[model samples]
Target: MGARNKLKELRLPKRSEIERFVKQRPTCGMEMLSFLNCLKANQFQDSACVRERMALEECVREHQSSTGSGSGRKRKDTLMYHLKRLYYLQRR
Candidate 1:
């Protein structure tokens, strides 16, 4: 009712605004792929792929710190970020 109407009235970001925040390739893509490959090669035995898993974790941490995403906020490149933002806006 009223809440739905208010939500519908809220202005959404333009396509260009969202596009700039979108990442063509995820951060640490290579490290992630390497980890997945190792897991597959090891027959999905996590114990046998500790090194690859560690490498991927390190890559993700480095990327998060470099991009200032270590603060626990959702990355703007993710759809979840926009959705949550919109939800909050509607609540306000």
Candidate 2:
């Protein structure tokens, strides 16, 4: 059984059951993903990508947190990914 199924089988308390959730519904998420991608694509070749990615990252984080997902079901850090690229570029 999956982890959630196992949790259910154990008859855990409501707070202890560990419900899984996402920042946004599938359609909303797809829309946001596409929009973010568009923002990152065809940048100015310098700070544009990083700057836009950071803004997108903050929006995603704020949306997810406002949904009460908290630390759970949070998506991967795309902002960090952009920051890493910027760091490498600066280092070169």
Candidate 3:
């Protein structure tokens, strides 16, 4: 079968099941595979994740533009430092 048809054939649990799963985990305990499977099975096409990421980028841009001085440069440097730290930690 085609990928699209296969995705449509998959079955996801009801909303209550999702709520129960979240309540039980309440942290980074949820399984990524399960979540992706659910999305694929349901053929969900919402771009909320992309939208939220874009919003965060816009906020950062605005902050940088408003503080066009040494402070703005410092803010970017700090962010880059933290991101590098996170990347290294993830690699380990």
- The lDDT for every candidate, in the order shown, is 0.80, 0.53, 0.50
lDDT of 1: 0.80
Ordered by TM-score, highest first, the candidates read 1, 2, 3
What's the TM for model 3? Answer: 0.25
The per-residue C-alpha lDDT of model 3 at residue 83 equals 47
TM-score each candidate: 0.51, 0.30, 0.25
Candidate 1 structure quality by residue, lDDT tens digits, 46-75 = 899899889989988888887777786754
Per-residue error at 17 for model 2, in Å? Answer: 33
RMSD of each: 10.6, 18.9, 22.6
- Give the alpha carbon lDDT tens digit for every residue of 26-71 in model 2: 5346545655676557553535456556666677777778665776
Among the numbered candidates, top lDDT falls to: 1
How many steric overlaps are in each model, in order?
0, 0, 0
Residue-wise lDDT of candidate 3 within 34-69, one digit each (tens)? Answer: 445555665764353444445555655665666675
TM-score of candidate 2 on Cα atoms, chains taken together: 0.30
> Which pairs clash inside model 2?
none
| lDDT, model 2 | 0.53
